[model samples]
Target: MTQAQSFSSTIFRRKPVVGARAPGQAADEPHLKRSIGTFQLTFFGVGATVGTGIFIVIPEAISMSGPAVILSFLIAGIAAGLAAICYAEMASAVPVSGSSYSYAYATMGEVVAVGIGACLMLEYGVSAAATSIGWGQYLNELINNLFGWSIPNELTAAPWGVDDPGWINLPSVILVVMCGLLLIRGASESALVNTIMVSIKIGVLLLFAAVCFTAFTSSHFSPFMPEGMAGVTSAAAVIFFTFIGLDAVSTAGDEVRNPQKAMPRAIVGALIVVVSIYLLTAVASIGAQAWTEFSPDDEASLSRLANSVTGSTWVGDIIALGAVISIFSVTLVVIYGQTRILFAMGRDGLLPKTFAQVSPKTMVPVNNTVIVCGVIALLGGFVPIDALWDLVSVGTLAAFITVSIGVVILRRTMPDLPRPFKVPGYPVTPVLSVAACVWILSGLAPVTFLFFGLWVAAALLFYFLWGRRHSKLNTGPASSADEVSQ
Candidate 1:
């Protein structure tokens, strides 16, 4: 066997493949089922990409860059689109499920894979928490608008979030727990559900745009570049969080009917759709009110803009309802991603074997899903939205940079390997993609950087203490299970 093939199989501890296993194994496929298609995958991308940020993060983006946040979205979209192309190459070349962790393992090395996993936790885990926190706010908006009463702060904030000073956020925790239950029960967000949620998310924002446009005044753009280039780019960094879900497009690699044709189109297509929606919304919101009014604590902020423009509570109520539903779905999709990554790690022997185990009856990674749910629940229950945002941005940007860099490394090592779509401008495209992501990453708050440093350090420590010693590679390709118990 070729060295890369031998190396990949051995390190992942999988049975030697005499032939390529089909996309999704049918029978003995252990939590593996060919139940998706290009449409559904695209729907997954759209659904996961829509919520949280567009609803709430918009206010912050406005507060930072004013109407120039429109410029920020344009810049961030180019960067996200560029990095996604790199990710597509890695996903296709590596042929694995755990996103960057899998790509790093197959192409980079064991140590890189473990470290990337740390970043994935930030990308998916912290993102799930951040998204859930948004869900709580929207839910309260819906409840208050519909019933004229909202849940008490103590019940909604985590036991840990600044209770007057509690450390945790309660509503977010409850949402996470509910998602965990659904996942454990083998429920998944099907294509229809994803599409419906995406529609709701986009619809709400579009609704805001339609209503707020009535108040449109060209004067809103008077001080267009008021923040200067530095502030615009910095706002781009904060606004960049909304773009993190674009990577969801890459993860659907295996299921597309014709990945080569379908992938490039879907990713670029999705990027265009998202960037347009964001730009339009920013313009509308800015027209309705000055950027300074976008307080971080403003509950149901966008919906409030709707009410402001229409002079009726109905518009805001509808926006709040849409935000609540869409954010909940986004949380579920992100959490599902986290469990699958852990499952891949377990299968590779990097994590405990129990993680990869699937309940035969349910055909889901019950234990792994449960563990992830519990951890995320704790974070959501206590951590505020502001704290989770930077960690998510930093983690995702780091991983994107790795993917962009990986494209260069893979091209050098496996020139002959078939690639459906070559990143348009190989060396330049990848290099630019990396630079753009770094610029945004540079603007992260100091505390976020410190936390990210600690997270990466912890991953490295675990790799040396356990991951490296127990890696499937050390024992050899699918070596008898006997040698696996480090």
Candidate 2:
């Protein structure tokens, strides 16, 4: 092949989808064991999702859209639902651990897959760090409420995140390490813990809804669209990060039982549960308190709202406790997703081989998980949460758009491919998903776009320098699991 043709082939090369096992499998070949079922998989979605977003985003959204944040929730839900539908098709068809990165690889090309992997890193790894910061704050609040004393600011706050910077966020580092150890134990144990946390999360939110509704008066919702559709759209963009858990569910495709069936179900089920809870909580919050009272800086907004409704501090204490647990689960699942994405990149020869090596005893990516957690712990301990959070919504929306487009591309390019679950209303659905994400993207701050642009550029630069030459697709056709050998 000419140099031009070879270069073209390198960038556009795609991977073929095959069965789960590595080709020429030996009795001792390492692979991610399939232990997750539909039930645990659904909790993975809920646990990763129902975290600091609901506790924090409600107030943030209300500040942006007034009581019309209700409309914002609906708009964001529709957009997320459309994306989830497209994701379901991709996850079911690809059935891999890399989420949208694998889908883009199979449909778009290796270069696009690298870009998608960059986006996933932002969505999972950075968000894990951000969530850890939130968890530390909530843990402090819970402790103060229960014992009338809290961790010193030097131990709980980041070095540069606020007016009062501290030496380090020790709790944030602790949280990340705790989640990493759980992941190293194995996927099933992590899933069970996540399920329990999700249940508590749901219960706490329901409790908030039940109590808030009792004090609910129709007066607060009057002039619902006060700031109009512009406000709703902007708020939707702000809160869109909450919906990313639906996509997180797909990252476990390699470890899920009957992935063709469970993958789609888990994605759809998680979307429904997350959207419903968000809507219910949004409505209750607006009804219980005039939207004007919400402050953007309130870290314990939900708990504060509960306090006003009950005229006591006990309910707020419980809400803070729940927030602590919820953020832990979020940090855990986001770290899990990040490790798996790196594992996939490693398996494709895009990253170091150590990332792809599954531990023989635990059937998990122990080294990869440790590396991911270590990086996240450093970020959480030293970096400002504000600097880390804006990128998450931008990254997540970009990845969702990729998945929607990939569904269309795969359908056209690989018409004969087996798809256990096909996207409903194919052409229109994917098109709408793309449009919705783009509209939300437009509403993000200019700083966020700048950050995103720089991140993507860095990712492509790495690909050209190293990944393009070393990619497995360049070597030859190999099964997806071929690179996982010990």
Candidate 3:
């Protein structure tokens, strides 16, 4: 065989260098602006993290552990915080756009990157769908409060919803499409919009907490651990979905100003704020109503709690309006994260070129955004919210474990590489992160694990059949102009 043929056969091998850019692309893409700061990045984390689960996951979590769900929040928060720290180290060290997918590729190998990319797609894409479903619920609540009527149940609910079965979820599809349109415009505008949404979301949650406390009764604390330690850990696994977007901060590593100082602070700050608010809300909610009264089928449980506590529909209307706005922002951010991950994979030759194409007019990957919106909208329109949540949690937990392990591997392989933020406890920190993730993974339902296994296997099969043969590294080194940017 000739030399060229021999070189082609080595496609299965890993791409060793970090931050490898595509051939002919400039060091800085002309379209994507690097204008995000610490404040903007923190909001990205907060905006993405809070709305996805809190708006919808509360009743589901309450059903799982009763009043002990507060402890579950703390457990999930710590696990997420540790994983985010490890994520910061990888972000600062690699300085890439793919989030965990890029970090896995640069440090682990091509195969691992492909696997993690699959998990991230599920994490962000399904998260977008789930949040949109939640948004639809809040929109219904808002309309009912303001106009004394809502869209017909047949048009607003998925088929699996017990109370109402619909042919399609119209509102969720519309919301996802709206977010996609905004994303196609550009990233800078999205960041500004997200900051505003974050403020509104935080303000409303605080208002709800304050009002709910007026109805607080100490008797609500009697049976805190209804299901015991087992229930607390299980609820933590379920609530883990809320923290999935904390890593969105790290995904902006290449876009942030002064990443070394900014990244860790933004991540930690977001975690603290998110966890504190969640705990306060959980306490106030159970205090306002009996834990047994939290109906798992109610998507707008928080608003309902507010209505019950204040004996009027006015407060519930305010909470619902805030949820509708903030959940829209959360959907936008997660969809943005999904598009970027696919774009990075395309650049490296793991997927189709259309994903990597950045439109000259907008400086964003318009094609990728559109594709993500199409898929996510379909899921949100047809799939039940409960069906989507566990899948998101499973994918996110697996991806977090991969990131924690990657940190340990990079430390051993490239000890001298400069990391803007290091995991504080060294090997122990990453190890504990991995352990926590595994424990959470164990708590997931067997059906969830089975579905996750099938999804991952399909992803690996695709890589072996197509990705290995078409990789950019198989061709040759990237052009000097497009060499990996530091």
Candidate 4:
């Protein structure tokens, strides 16, 4: 057979292409300012990780595990941290912006890359929608506390909301649109903004914990494991959504100044800070009231907790206001991450090229941002918040497990490649990362897995029908191939 025929036959083949520069990145292109240090990157991780789930997830988790939800938090954190360590190695090796999608493409086959991209869509896109929904609830709380007026139920709630079914969630849709506009305008979360957001998030949680602790009673701790080990694992699976953004630290690997030393520090630091805050807040909240009082249907549970603990509405108002501000930023960040991931896929020809188009005026993917926000707004405006959180957890867990496996695959395939940061326990760490994620996956409701499987299958179908024929690999030089096998 001719060389051209040989190359064409290998188009769908697996290739190990770590550290390859992404399409559109030019040799002469100006370098991104190497301004992010460990402290700043740590803040980015914390800022992205905290707000989305804590404001709304607490009640859901509590309902599952009672006072033992604290143990769930710890389990989720350890799993997240281990996956993050593996992610650091992948990021340092690949040094690109697509997060797990990019990592999988470099080490695994094109089909797997497309599958992981679908998982990321759920993680970032749906999480943004879920957080926006939570933000609307807090916005209503803040408005009512200050002005004695609330957004009408029809405008503030989704069709399937717990207390009141509404035609649409206008506030959540508005929040998503606002964030979309900012992204189109080239507004990004700089290091300073990240620090400020982190501070606001931590400050509000601390205030809630301190006030709730004042009303703590030992009797609330009885029968801590009310539902036993099953409940604890299930709660951990649900709460795992809170740690989804920890890998944002790895995605910025290329832009950091001294990634080898700084990446590990920032990831570990963010994990510790987030875990500590979650545990403290959980303990304070459960101590202040019986676990049975926690309700998954309550949209503004933290604010209500503050009010109940202090016997005043003003304290709850403070918590609500903080959630409004901080969750707005979280929505923006998650939306930004989603657009970039799609942008990466477009560049690789896994999707239409429209997604890769960069606006001359803004130098960002404007079309991609619009498409992402439109879908997110639809979900936020119509779907109930409770249903979206578990989907986010499932997608994130699958993506993290893929990253861990990618780490082990790259180690065996390219043993001599330069690595800026390595997983501490090497094979053991990656293995455990996979195990933890699998354990959490096992605890998710069967319905969640069914939905996830359908989504992944759809992505693979698109790949076979369209992506393989259009792939950049078919057109690039044979020498450009990263790896090839007969």
lDDT of each: 0.72, 0.85, 0.81, 0.80
lDDT (tens digit, per residue) of candidate 4 on 117-143: 999988888899999998998999889
Candidate structures ordered by TM-score, highest first: 2, 3, 4, 1
lDDT order of candidates, best first? 2, 3, 4, 1
- CA shift of 368, model 2, Å: 1.2
Best by TM-score: 2
Model 1 agreement with the true structure over 81-146: per-residue lDDT tens digits? 888888776655554457676666555666677788889877889889888888878888788888
Clashes of each: 20, 0, 0, 0
Candidate with better lDDT, 1 vs 4: 4
* Model 2, span 296-415: residue lDDT tens: 766778888898999998999999988988989988898999988888888878887888899889999999998999999999999977787668888899899999999888777676
User: All candidates' TM-scores?
Assistant: 0.89, 0.95, 0.93, 0.92
Q: Is candidate 1 or candidate 4 better by TM-score?
A: 4
The ten-residue window of minimal lDDT in model 3 covers 477-486
Best-fitting candidate, measured by lDDT? 2
Residue 460 of model 3, lDDT score: 87
Off by over 4 Å in 2: 21-30, 478-486
Model 1: lowest-lDDT 10 consecutive positions: 16-25
Among all windows of ten consecutive residues in candidate 2, which has the lowest summed lDDT? 477-486
Instruction: Identify the runs in model 1 with alpha carbons over 4 angstroms from their true place.
Output: 1-31, 159-168, 185-191, 252-265, 477-486
User: Per-residue lDDT for 1 in model 1?
Assistant: 100
Q: Which pairs of residues collide in candidate 3?
A: none
